[model samples]
Target: MSPMLDPRRLTPRPIPHLPEISKRFDGVVNCSDDTNIEGWKKLLRDDRPMKLAAGSISVVEIESKVLTTGFLEFDFVVEGTGDAPEIQILCAESYENDMDKGQPRSKDDRTNFRTGKLYGPTDTYFCNTKLSRNHYEPFWWRTFRYLRISVSCPPTSSLIFNSITYRSTHYPLPITTSVSSTDLVDKLHSTSVNTLLNCMHETHEDCPYYEQSQFAMDTRSQLLFSYTISHSDLLARKTIHEFYASRRDDGLLETHFPNPGRGMNIPQFSLYWIFMLQDHMIHFHDLALVKRYIGTADGILDHFAGRLNEKGLVGKFEVEGTWAFVDWVGEWFTPVKGFSSMGVPKAYYEKGAATVNSLVYALALKSAAEMCTALGRNDTTTEYLERAESIIQAVNEHCYDVKNGIYLDGPGATGQYSQHVQIFAVLADAVNGEAARTLMRRTIRERETLGLAKASFAMSFYLFRAAVKAGIYEEVWEELLSPWKKMLDQNLTTWAESESMVRSDCHGWSATPMYEIMREIVGVKSGWNETKIIPRVDLVNEMRGSFVVAGGDTVDVSWGESKQVKLKASKDMEVELVLRATSIHIKLLQGEEQCFSWT
Candidate 1:
């Protein structure tokens, strides 16, 4: 294996724009309270909308030739004799359809002369002509396919732009991977990858347009997605360093890092930091990097070790006023009748031992144990494993409903359940095989099942993983596509934070489709010494793909027509071809290829 590079030295790889596109003014008209171009067309200049004043306001619609590119920063040179025409540039991903809502869409598509032109970070900005620069760019990059440059200048001022173009930027990693499947599957995969590219900035942002926070839960999916598509671990390593940098005096990690102020504390987010570390080691297998962070992992474990309840489950936050958020579940966050106003139910969140929290803690402990064992810290491993087992026993006895055959949300929860605890149960191996299958079928699989709400975008990753463990790939794919297609129907260019009228249009957590296609559908999982090739032929009749995996090996896999499957690797590599939960081990010299049929 090649020696690992220092991840700290990684820099942003700028993706320069192709030869500039010459865009022409489609028309000069008034667009007010309009959500679609057709809606704007219905309103003429004669209507004299409140915001679109007669001479003071004019919407300059710029249309570019059909050029396919990911949305990034737009550079515009606004040259005007008077007051540098205040401009609001709106970018869109699809111009052919109403999906190009001219600008970012909000629930309230109203026209207000005061703030109507403002939307998120892409709002109106006045160019500084005296600063020795004629061009204007925002603090962050904006995503778009079409640009709606709204220049509102005074009646006496004439405004014209010399050069208006866009420059795309990302981690600049090469796309050393390919996925081939059905047409719809291909589109889904592209959308997922696009979401990841947009979400990744200086640090892994949850979304570029909104919040712009580097959230651990959100970036975890993006990290895994990058490994499959980009085949680089630099960003993942950088993210781990950032999370460790955000560690508090008490050793807890922040929900979002590099905060302007002290970071917001979420007890569960700190636990996810541990999971992220383990996940990175699993994919990259850089022992030096893993060893460097083992102490940080120990610090995190130490923080939680002091908070375990008598029953050995993490109870309430010993650190006062800390948010013990598990997921955005109504049961966890939304107060029941008769509780205090403006706060979540204490029993569900702060007070009792939550099944989700304890299970995740147990999983984290087990993960830490594995990492410790890998690092030759057997004492730490034994300690973590034993503690994890105690918590698991406590969870099964206290949280699991013996009669209902499912886990409760918390020890105090009675009829109150969710897909989260059960999913985590399978992930932690607290439940497996028949028990897990039964739990998922009863709690998660059935559409008519009503007790628990579905997972939010952040938690859906685990939902997918647990479903796979339970051998529910069919249901997993179906469940995965529903929300994604819904977003597509709404013409969302980037993944949404939730399936609602939320402010953030783009989020990294929702970029699950691409990672699943590569990992689950194509089944290319990486390890330090070898890569595991396990394509799920059951999901699709014909599936074929190639990806550069861990240790710099290019793997090509195809399963079709007959049960026979073809596989190949570009380097001397060891591979585990997993089928029906059984692993078939194989090895190859450099540039070797082989084909095998599944029985």
Candidate 2:
């Protein structure tokens, strides 16, 4: 008899661009209007189109010389003598249509069909003045070029656009995974895909089927990539605030209710989403979002308050008796009584009662403090701060093992073993010198011990900040930038989902690691608080420069052997220079020369 078929090695269907040249799968442009009116849906309303922001992207087969995608890192340039050029590139390719009807071909069948440019970011501004006339990247599916450029306008509005240019990089377009039901290589993964770029601008409480929740919480967790792509914010305030705006009076805040976890029934990511939203606010200080969700933001606090146990803690809401996102053991954030899938041990979660709840509460409280303070709620601000303090104290009492100088939760001879707890503890600033030091040591030594429940980005940030605190700022750069290095290496551009050490998703929140690397690895601190200057040129040896997100005032700090280190800022203002060691001291005021220990 012939060898039987082995149902293992199944790769998900890859999105096809040209003739049979599929690489690895990435993302897509979703334009489905099936659930437009649903509370949370990706498609725009029937009356008009939804606000699709990403460039209409497709993975077209291209040889090395042909132009492809994006507007950055390309050899060509936009043309504009006196004004910016209006440029738009269209990416179209044949997609594999899995759904088939009225024929012998089943829905599982894969066949190629053509697709064209969908939509891109609204109110796009351009300022290219070099390649306006010859802005085309020819492809195998090369279509006709269309243009209606009119430069002479009302001076301020249309006159600004005079060129169109595209960015070409080593990053290749995604090829869909070709996995079928019969063949299974890895652990079970869901197989319902919509588009690579799934977005929902608005949702209402009355709408049926929490489709927005569906898109976000799907098994793929791919939507989380919105934060990692070009022009992305892995975690955005608007995403969470609008989600909150659609909450019902009963405070149920949407649910997968009947189906539970079968599909992306977001019975309640409200808590998680709100926490993420507040995180962005603190990092970016986007007051527009604060003002938009001021009232709803308070409403979220009320939810936390009402849900707290008699001791002001939440239960592991996802699964009972299980530790949630944070921990409640060792020198930890004192796990609040809440349900979380963020930071629980996979084994510990078998019976539910894993106790890594402390981290979530600490972050939630800190977020609360930030949101409250930003919203001008003085009373709430104080309450949240006190709550955060109390939680820290409680975590110390329960999760911390003072003798061992570590804290963790869960039921076991050794309890929960994690490093993310340490990261969150540092991020929350809830621990002390010795514990922080130990926690930092564990993270530097062991990377993935406790991040099972949390996202990899959480660990990345933890590593970055802990490195800064431990005065290994350069190490932090390597830790934080490692993920991006992998992404850039694999593809010229990053995608929503990844195939790295952790294959979840690429997100704006993940990209924040870049910001952390710039601020912490280089040891740059700002604000009315204490000032810090620890120059780190060591890590730059690994990669080129990176940008700082809406960072504070300009800074100048570095140490080099027989070299003049120049630090420039936006404006030359009064400054303070403090060195970590007297061995290299610099005292410069108002752009004056500061003496350094040049080795």
Candidate 3:
């Protein structure tokens, strides 16, 4: 059986007062100011309650000042001669235009309450008592920045709005790490942390809103983000085991776990599950943990191995019920007259092998080989490495577009190129060194002109990795982060699901900047056996932060424009400092500070 799930301890916090309020009605209301409603103010005070007449509607908007996940509580009393009154509560991360005007509404200022409107799932309640205080609270917690409540009474009844409050809830994971730099970077870091917090609870949810499912692809990135801030692997371990339990008879794992009903399967997500297992092995360095899931990893790889086509590459998933989701590119969502699949490229619908699917399978094989090497299983390691290399060679031989100087979406896929295939090609080692760098540079620079399919927020984590591997991270940093900067520019307190901003406003996958900021900007790279401090001095002049490494040890690093560097470790450990072209290896003693200058 899987490990016992950890119990969550949530604390209830009071919302002192409402931030902003607006009302539209057709009936009488008792208030000091007709233009300005003081009824909400009465909820805070115990003296006199805000009274609403029959048919009167009041929309009280409350801003928590930050993104939060929690249950809402409100107390009120009813006095009337007719039927019970109805209360409606709507929650949203931000306000938007009531109607889509065929333009990007995400660019509009979210703080201007008068111009935008709030839209989200609404919960309603009916008051039954005549003169006694009635309390109302929802069964499930909601994720929101804005909470709008409207109370309407019958022809003779009225509602005395006594008080309203909300109890904030989370997984109780304390963030011990910290990083700071320019205003934008700092905001990006803090906002990313908030977004991650909102998505994490009993399981690593894709988002607290909409579907609170623990998707494999989303959980992999989220687990890495958790490792940067907090050292506790309780949630990560639980998630890994749960996904392993979701395996089917065909050896393919379900896309998400804890799904009670008929589960959906995404072929690529099963590959991501192996990545999650490898990630746990890297951060925690627990051999027993790796051994436990290594069989499950092999089973998943074996399933893909059996599906290789005549060209020696993993073929398209023709299973009766499965999705081959690579990324959420707008070009892939085009409607086909007879095809049922949407949000996937046309090549995926055809009978050929997809370059992205084969590349991901190859990447997973390499990851599994690393785990096998750790366990001293040389034979298994050799088998996985050889299989991975063969798939990489097959993809290079069949999918490379000589004319465009890039990899195609699939074999014989003319004029169908995407950043996804290119990113995976570099990651899976199908291309390396100068070839990889040149291809990535072209992909980033000419994506718009070439009409290449772009990677949305969910796929950006891999996009950043490909850039780093190509040695062009600093060159394309600004362009890569423009989407997030746009969200901040639009006054978003949390990350949106995608650039489209049509769905969830708080997807944890979009919180990948937290991982990149810590790993790349802070330059604290922790591996399975060693910790490396290689600050990208070119990115920022000065930076400082501490992160939890393997075995629950803390490493602190700080550097400035003077080229002076100071670092310390919580215990005796081996550390490597990469300063430009030179590498200095040192041993850090417990609580001892190591000082040096790069110059």
Q: What are the models' TM-scores?
A: 0.80, 0.50, 0.91
Which residue pairs collide, candidate 1?
Answer: 92-145
Cα-lDDT of candidate 3: 0.81
Ten residues in a row with the worst lDDT in model 2? 184-193
lDDT sort, best first: 3, 1, 2
lDDT tens per residue, model 2, 1-599: 77598768975433222222312112122323323223112111121222211222112221211112222211223322554434343332122223244322111101122332221122222434554432333331211111111122222222211122333222122322221211111111111111222121221111111122322122112223222121233223334543554564534244322223333223224445555556456445676766666565456546555544434334335333222333222232324533344334542344233334545556666776777777788897898788777766655555565655555544231544466556666666767576676667665655455432333543454456565666455544455455455543332121223222222222222334324333443444443323345444443322112122223333444444433344434434433443344223333354444444323
Location of the lowest summed lDDT over 10 successive residues in candidate 1: 42-51
- Give the per-residue lDDT digits (tens) of candidate 1, residues 1-599: 77687557765653332232333323222343244344233222222222333246656443333222333333334334456557787664333212245754543221222333333224667755454234565654555434565767665344444334445555555688888878767777877777787777678888765576888777777787787786567668778988888877887877798789774477777778888888888877777888988888888888777777887777777535476666654444444423221223334553366678788888889998999898899998999999888889988878878877778777857777777888899999899988788777776555247477567777787888888888876765776678777766655556667643345556778888887888888788777766787778777777777777876568888778887677877877778988756789988666566878777
Candidate 2 to truth, TM: 0.50
Model 2: lDDT to the true structure: 0.38
lDDT by residue for model 3 (266-307), tens: 888999999999998888889999999999999999999988
Better of 1 and 2 by lDDT: 1
Using TM-score as the measure, what is the rank order of every candidate, best first?
3, 1, 2
Error of 3 at 10 (Å): 22
Index of the highest-lDDT prediction: 3
